[model samples]
Target chain A: MTQVSDAPAKTRAQISQKTLRTDRWWEQPAIVATLLTIWVTYATVHVFIGKWYWVPQYHYLTPFYSPCVSGECVPGAASLGTWFGHLPPIIPYAVVSLPFVLGFRLSCYYYRRAYYRAFWRAPAACAVREPHQKYTGETRFPLIMQNLHRYFFYMVILISILNTYDVIQAFHGKTGGIGFGLGTLIMLVNVVLLWCYSLSCHSCRHITGGRLKHFSKHPVRYWIWNRISWLNARHMQLAWTTLGTLMLTDLYIWLVAAHVFSDFRFYN
Target chain B: MSYKAALRVWRGDHGRGDLADYAVEVNEGEVVLDVLHRLQATQAGDLAIRWNCKAGKCGSCSMEINGRPRLACMTRMSTFTEDEVLTITPLRTFPVIRDLVTDVSFNYAKARQIPSFTPDPSVGLGEFRMQQADVERSQEFRKCIECYLCQNTCHVIRDHAENENAFAGPRFLMRVAELEMHPADTADRRDIAQDDFGLGFCNITKCCTEVCPEHIKITDNALIPLKERVAGRRYDPLVWLGSKIARRPRSTGTPKVPDNRH
Candidate 1:
């Protein structure tokens, strides 16, 4: 490296302080840590609770238990068929899909930034010094697994299709007519947000139009790419929004299933 | 509307420093730079500062105002309340030369590391014709004033001095993105971006984007797209399989321009 004339003769200033920033730099990371911890704790407990995940009357199944593939599931809840027989309490009923969902969020570009800053304290905010001395980032071993985000993207697409199917089945009424209710509306909103989040993924954008030499040649792909690009700009917002929607959808179903409150029927 | 604004400016050389307090005159239309200039003129003539184009365009007067990276020329004094002590400090990411000036050669070094745009051999000068859409794709990045605010704000090199040798911060990474997106450029920058430039170190925190004065979506338009382009070559299994089947060399020196380009 060529040393320029104005290069600093000394190393970084030997100030014995971690940072000179006086702003509330820690607030953002603290909020992120608190929210993520709460979400993870809730998700873990609900995934294992296994009961009150289905309401047979309204066909309202919490996303946490969708495609509930166990013989223990309520008869109508096992829409995808019970591939797994009665298992021990340790495993989740949606075990097949849960890992892929977890992997999708774990490897998402936006979520990666959130967790890395919040949980890992990788310079929690800009200019803040982190505790760790050596930073290899995603170059080696466990972190290199982040490159599998594209694969997780693919898996999440398949799971989204299944989630869409669950939404379709959710149209059932108590009287067996086409149903529309508060549960249906909540599930509909959740599924729509899920699609928005998935479609706006960086991997999806790449698959749609990336690597193409000329946009003129692929008009169809170009159109889709442009739309995805718009959504891609809001990927961070969509990521957090979907998490909230997913929890809300699951919680609504859990409450209905547990008979905490009856589903508010808009029509039957 | 004129009053004495309490200003705290970091003072000292590369060896050591501490914040020095001053009461500088401030007028309604004046900026932080104006106040600093007044301080320099009246109180301390020896105070060191670097500035060019008192307008925000030159990007030479980058400093931290109350722990935020900003161009002193752009920050109005009216934004601060009367009681608030306006603390101006040099950028934390780089070595300070004196008060409010740091050796930004770190950015220049990173800029030198990136290979410049290598146009396709087939496309002669003046023969290059680009669609408007294609031109606009990279034009957003061209607005960068090289303030190095993005560099100073990026946590990769800011906190971890060890990673300085590898990571090329957001500004130069955006430069690579610009070249990579250029329809005529032929040289493959994906490998160099991931391997040599330490693009992986950027976890898309968006701090660079947040600090950008140009409002360039550095994380969205440049970095993420560049990362996707790299992934297409390195990680996509289908692309890997197709490349193996076709027996095509990865870094062939030809641009991927479609034959339709006139």
Candidate 2:
């Protein structure tokens, strides 16, 4: 509410006007379609291969549970071989991720801002006026699926531990070679996806001390954490990471559930 | 103690601008804005200055001194050396109309979009209860003076104008965050904030907090918490399931930069 008064006003000095480029060329339908096509296709393929082959082949842990031979598996499971014969724990993973993915997708505070910048005003400058874009329901379903992040974070950690335990169980047997199971593989991939998501969160970036003026000295021996916070200084990086990884994790799980290739097994 | 200082003031509007020099005599306890008024009364009777509640409470009298955003009324004239000249200009973010005044209607327009408070019918006024901590969180945001200094200093909207379409700026974001965090508030403006108002453009630079007159942690306490909630909702799978079970359709409204996003 700045105000001006009249009384023999001071002489005016003119500022030079520059021709501004005012169009959001990136958000055009053709571009949007191309980008989305590449993104979804890449995500679908990665999830399929990672869950089915890569995780099971490389990581000792698999998504499937093994049966109890001598109280090796959970109670009531018959043998070490029987427990490794079930579907990946989809219910637990989905249940844990529900709140995080759904809550944020419903709220949508961050995505709106991110897309506005990433799409419409990619190279942000001073004073470029553009009409607001009418937000159709395109990004909703996956955004609704975003609530899975926190729960995914929680589940992935738990599942990773479970997979670790499965690895230990494999060694206890005579073969000593960790056999791959589908469930252990899914859990392992879940952990990786969750890591990509959590490390990119806006909150986690701050805890890492992004752009903070200074840090305190008292927390002893954990100085390493403080140093890493410095690397997490770029706010936009965290914003993008948190955004992309959350969406990717959901895509991963959905693909696993869909069984796109069908051999992407979660159990023996 | 008596003091002497030179004031370099921007004395015109969008049509013209200049730094006019003036000498001022004041006591150690006086404020810079007070000195400007005095100089206006004696040396330059035609000079116009806008201010209210010379106390920092009203948020008026926001001006820049030596290239830094400040409340003229809150700045101590004693901080500058007697030989030094203080350069004063209206806040840079807004358009100057004549002198130290500019059209700030843009902020008002943004404020109008926020959804008003809507309490759930189940929690009647009489039975409503919340722990003291929840109430305290909202109290922190109540300190804003609307001086627009935070708005002025924000690089996203001030230095980077392209962000105006999506970014609601810091002041507005803090206000919305406040309301959203209110224990009794049932309105979920986060969707609106995301889709329309542009809360995500902030990037958490903390420059807004650095220049805030009242020292409210606009980024840390307010914006960041709201971001967490928004991010949580966007990604939390449990809430998604709950919405499905409860049959609550996802809201599709544009987020408005509410009067206060605290």
Give each candidate's fraction of reference contacts reproduced.
0.43, 0.10
Off by over 4 Å in 2: A1-268, B122-127, B235-262
Candidate 2 lDDT by residue in tens digits, B1-262:
7866788888876747777898878877889888998888889887777798989999888877765678889999877777778877777667777677765655766666666666777986789766654565577788988888887666665544445555667888888887776767766777766666666565544557767889897876777666666664565556677788886555444234343332
Model 2: per-residue lDDT, tens digit, A89-153?
Answer: 33221223234343432233344444444454422322222234433222246434433334444
lDDT of 1 by residue, A1-268 (tens): 2232333424554455666667789999999999989898998999999898888888988889877998798889998889888989998998889998999999998999899989898868876677887787888778877877888899899989989988888898999979879999999999999999999998898889855656766779988989999998789899999989999998999899888999999988
**Model 1, range B78-139, lDDT digits (tens) per residue?**
88887789888888778988888888987876676677779867777899887776677788
Judge the docking of candidate 1 as incorrect, acceptable, medium or high.
Answer: acceptable
